[model samples]
Target: MNPFDPTVHLPDELLERIRERAPIHDRDNTFPEQDLEELRAAGYLSILVPAARGGAGLSLAQAAILQQRLASAAPATALAINMHLVWTGVAKVFSDRGVPGLEFVQDGAVAGEVFAFGISEAGNDLVLFGSDTEAAPTADGGYAFTGTKIFTSLAPVWTKLGLHGLDTTSPDAPKLVFAFVERTDAITTSDDWDTLGMRATQSRTTRLNGAVADAAHVVRRIDAGPGPDPIVFGIFSVFEILLASVYTGIARRAIDLAVHAASSRRSKKTGAAYSQDPDIRWRIADMGLAYDALPPQIAALARDVDERVDNGARWFVLLSGVKHRAITMAKHVVDQAMLVGGGGSYFSSNELSRLYRDVLAGAFHPSDPESAHATAASAWLGPLES
Candidate 1:
């Protein structure tokens, strides 16, 4: 087998096409179905599955880099695909650890089945540790999940929904059930995805009404509330790293645009290019300084996950910290780019304007500002007294 080359999987021509369509999707506030189809044809959806599983067999680190590149072209497209990659990445984690289960996920991906992440709930800050959804056991030893999932990206096209619900009627009673269910009649995806940015994602609200995950699809049954479950680690690690990659891509795009703007626009006062202006130079340099630190961080941490380097309790701290930093840094870079682009960027038609709105969605993702700070504080100082 050859070393994985991202360009082979995601060529520049494909990225340019996706970039060309990004503005249209954003303007129309629609899902990038064409982008999805193109990526699917490129075998991008199966990038993380093992080679024997008929995938690209790329490492999580490589996937992170590809995602960054994709995001630079179409941020919402990259973000929407992130959910699918998360499941495959988790499957890889299970495979590498010799853990049983999740082979179905790998098989499903190879078979061209789309998986949508269905864990987030409104106002559920416990994230991955607990669930408001109820998981009632069936006679067949499967489970029926009943709850609403928010921010369900790929709602329109996902064939499988990977979700979690709390089981209260079992012998152990109160086990968190992680399972996958087909998108059947029981699932309802609301058409309420209008937003300031990332409109192309179409990440709408999802309602699961007695949605069933058969015994074969039931992957995990563990005690709720913060245990050392590989599923938890898998989701958190892949999710945060990929998310950071997306925002880092946004920052990279913003810097590139700023560079273009600085070079093309000439200052009337000095009759020199804005790139020659000291203020613009400093601003661009500041953006570079901030942006330079992120990709390497994403690469290093993703490599750690791929190599299984044990950071133990610090894993969450590090994961959440990188995500937090990526979003903040990307936002700063985009803001600076907007200023550098001047009044023209304020128009809705400008790409920088779109990026400005798209970057805001990063803050709403998991490990939010408050949660990141809380995690770091607990890691540094002991948990606060009751």
Candidate 2:
């Protein structure tokens, strides 16, 4: 296949259109359905589904680059779509490793089916290691999931919900079930999604009451706590890397905005552009230095996953660290951009102001500051004496 060129799939014109709609969605606190429609029409929804499976057949690294570009234009749109891409990315992991279960996911994406991530639960810090939700096996090989999933992106339009729960009734007596269920009557999506940033995501709460995943859709049943399961690795690796790409893109946009502000805004004292000011130059340079450090890290790690390079147990640390770094760096760059943007950026209508708000949501995503620190600490210092 030809080297994945992002501009081919996501043209400058398409991105400009999406960028134009971002503030409208943010202001109205509405999902960017038009953005989704354009992306879907452009075959972006199936970018990783493998060329043979009728997709763009891009690697995870390529996907990361594309997502960063997409996020630069409309962060909330990119973020909302990231959930759908996560499942597909996981399916790619399965296919690449000679696994057979997730072909349906690839096919589903090609068929224009939208998949929503439904893993997050309130107060469940165990994350991928455990689940507070219940998963009961049915007479058939399927399982029924009952729980409430918080922060379910693509809540309004997902045709299938991919989620997990704990099954205590089987002989194993405590297995984590990862499965997918169609959006039937058993599932309810709450209308509560108001937030300070990324408002266009419309990532509302999801309630699963006896939602059944047929045998085919039931992907994995593994021992609860973190283990050497491929599913676990696939989810974590793709999720963290893709997430880092989004925030890194946010930082990239901030840098561009800062450059524009510095060039366009002039100081009354010298009647010269802010770009000529020593302090502003230093700030922009600092932002560039910080931002330049992340994409390579993301690309290398993503390439490792793509090429099946075993990073061993350090994989989690690396993934979480990159995500943590990306968000924190993005926040810093946006802060700098706000300063360079002058008092006008403080207004709600300013793009820099929107970016400031959007960047805040990065801290709340997985591998949060606390969890990222905990993972890194455990990796380097070993588990604390308990």
Across residues 281-312, which tens digit of lDDT does each residue of candidate 1 receive?
A: 99999999999999999999999999989999
Candidate 1 lDDT (Cα, 0 to 1): 0.96
Question: Model 2, 84: alpha-carbon shift in Å?
Answer: 0.7
Model 2 has a clash total of: 0
Off by over 4 Å in 1: 1-4
Alpha-carbon local distance difference test for all models: 0.96, 0.95
**Backbone clashes under 3 angstroms, per model:** 0, 0
Candidate 1 worst ten-residue window by lDDT: 1-10
lDDT of 2 by residue, 1-386 (tens): 56667999899999999999999999998999999999999999999999999998899999999999999999999999999999999999999999889999999999999999999999999989899899999999999999999999998889999999999999877999999999999999899999999999999999999999999999999999989999999999999999999999999999999999999999999999999999999999999999999999999999999999999999999999999999999999999999999999999999989999999999999989999999999999999998
- Provide the TM-score for each candidate, comma-separated: 0.99, 0.99
Regions more than 4 Å wrong, model 2: 1-3
